[model samples]
Target: MLLREIQDEILRLKQEKDIAILAHSYQSHEITEVADFVGDSYALAKKAMTLTQKTVILCGVRFMAETVKILSPEKTVYLANSSAGCPMAEQFNKTDIENLRAKHPDYTVVAYINTTAELKTVCDVCVTSSCAEQVIRSMPQDKIIFVPDINLGTYCKNLVPEKDFILLDGGCPIHASMTENDVFKVKKQYPSAVFLAHPECKAEVTKQADYTGSTTGIMEYAIKSDKKEFIIGTENSIVEHLKYKCPDKKFFPLSNNFICGDMAITSVFDILDCINGKGEEIKIDEDTRIAAKKCIDKMIEYGG
Candidate 1:
């Protein structure tokens, strides 16, 4: 079947079956085009809670699907493609943080929302790339242990200097793959373009960027800016997404290697398989679910 035909059928079946599709910003345009909602992982999870559908298909990755289930425990959630997994999300296990927590007994443990549900159970609060700085600033603790993404932890540390942060040697390989050399090379090519980077990038890369933010923030900045050209420092898919959203504006990738194989693995066919009951269901034990939600709830409270 053609892409449009698959999308049309997905639209029909989702409505007929009372299922909502949540697509991450990193997902392909074809998947997002047919999704009921499209946004960042944390935002998509929050969206799932407000959705009236009893079932949800997340066309992102394992951690993202788990987040939706964490927020909306009553709703049945499925990861469209079971193999779609984030390297950063699975970078560290429970023991790693547990060891850190054991060492820093008085420090608040902050878990980035990209983490797995099991990891969040031991966290004090949760944060997204957009809200990490704000949430950390709002936190009463003088010390914080930011985990599984040292690049983002470094980004937050720069913004909220009052708190002491313990950053682990972990991060999104795809985002960290982008270096300052990529920025300089891209800038040499597009001297007039503004560089907008995701916080997941290495500090050296983000330091050179005109703006550093989440994927949604980067998109919003590109859309609102009067500037005609932008160099996106996140996933390469954002270039395609921006081109479709702002045809008048030109978008360029900071590096061709910024592509995420995990996000790319999910396709519209997976959504079709999901609607036909072939996708992997996201299931969390009651104990883990409740334990995991406290940190997310803290995120809303602090980030709000």
Candidate 2:
């Protein structure tokens, strides 16, 4: 089938099935075009709770679908592709955090929202990239453990230097692959362009950036800034996304290596199959769901 035909079908079927489709910014432009909402994973999860639809189709990864299920336990959630899991989310198990907790009982466990359901259960609070600095600064504890993303932890650490943070050496390999050399090279290529870097990249990379932010942050910075050109430091898809949204603006990739193979796993065809009720159901037991939700609830309670 053609692109338009598939999109029309997705629109028709999702409405017919009482399903809300949520796409992440990292997803392809074609998928985002047919989605009911497109943003970051946690933002999409929060959006899922507000919709009247009973079913939600997550066009992201396993952990994202799990988050949708975590926030809206009553709603039925499906992952567009079952095998599309996040390497960063799965890097550390619950036991790893448990052991860390045992070692440092007084330290607050601050979890990145990209973590697994089980990992969140033992966490004191949760934070998105956009809110990590604020949330961490709000905490009363002097010591904390930020999990799964060393780059993000470092980003947060630099911003909130008053508190002590213990970071595990685990993060998105795709973003971690970027280096300060990439930024300098891209800057040389586009001397006047504003460089927007994601927090997932190394501190060296983000430090050289003109602006450091989340995926949504990067997009908004590019669109709202007066600068007519930008080198997006996140996923390569943001370039296409921003180009489509702002025709007058010029967007370029910081490097060709910024592409994420996992995010690209869910093609329009996968969404088509999902609309046909062929996707995997994200099932978290009630106990884990309830326990996992407390930290997310704390995040919302803390002004996320």
Candidate 3:
């Protein structure tokens, strides 16, 4: 079947089934075209909560679908690709965090939204890449525990040195693979381009970046900037999406190794299969759901 034909079927089925499709910004442009909403994981999950659809299809990672399920417990959430999971999210379980909490009883447990719902149940607050700095700063606690992604934790830690942030050695392998050398190589190639990076990258990579932000933040920065060229430091899909969005502006990826295999695994067929009820439906226990929501509620209270 043709791409258009498949997308048309998906479009029809979603409406008929009262399903809302949420795609992450890291998704392929083709998937984004068919999605009802596209943004970062936390943004898309928040968007899912506002949807009237009885069902939601998260065309991203498992953690993202879990987040949607937590926010809108009344609605059923399905992961388009069942195997799509974040390594970082799976790195630390509840027990590992609990052990750390035991050590630092005075510290606030701040879990990145990339974590599983189970992890959030034990967390004091949830933060997204887009609002990590602001949310972390808003906390009344002097000491904090930033889990799952040490790279992002380091970025936020450096921004607010006054706060004591306990870091873990887990992060997105794709983003973490990039280094200062890669940034220098890309900058040398695109001499006139501005360097934009994600905080998930290492300190060396972020240190050389002209701007560092979330997926949506990077897109908005590039769009608003008068510069005709940019080196994107996030997922490789952003370069393709940006090229299509702004033909006049040239977009170069920081490294060819920036590809995220997990995010790239979902196909249009996966969306079709999901809408057809063949996908993985994310389920959480009532106890887990209620407990998990506390951190998210705190995030909203803190203006996340």
Model 3, 174-206: lDDT tens per residue?
998998889888899889999999999999999
Write one digit per residue (lDDT tens) for candidate 1, span 1-304: 8888989999999999999999999999999999989999988988998999999999998999999998898998999999999999998899988988899899999999999999999998999988888889887887999988999999988888888999999999999888899899999999999999999999999999999999999999999999999999999999999999999999999988889999999989999999999999999999999999998999889863
- TM-score per candidate, in order? 0.98, 0.98, 0.98
Error of 1 at 126 (Å): 0.5
User: In lDDT terms, how accurate is model 3?
Assistant: 0.92
Please identify which of the two predictions, 1 or 3, would achieve the higher lDDT against the true structure: 1
- The alpha-carbon deviation from the true structure for residue 205 of candidate 3, after best TM-score superposition, in angstroms, is 0.5
> What tens-digit string does per-residue lDDT give for candidate 2 at 128-236?
9999988888777879899989999999988988899999999999999999999999999999999999999999999888999999999888888998999999999
Error of 2 at 3 (Å): 1.6
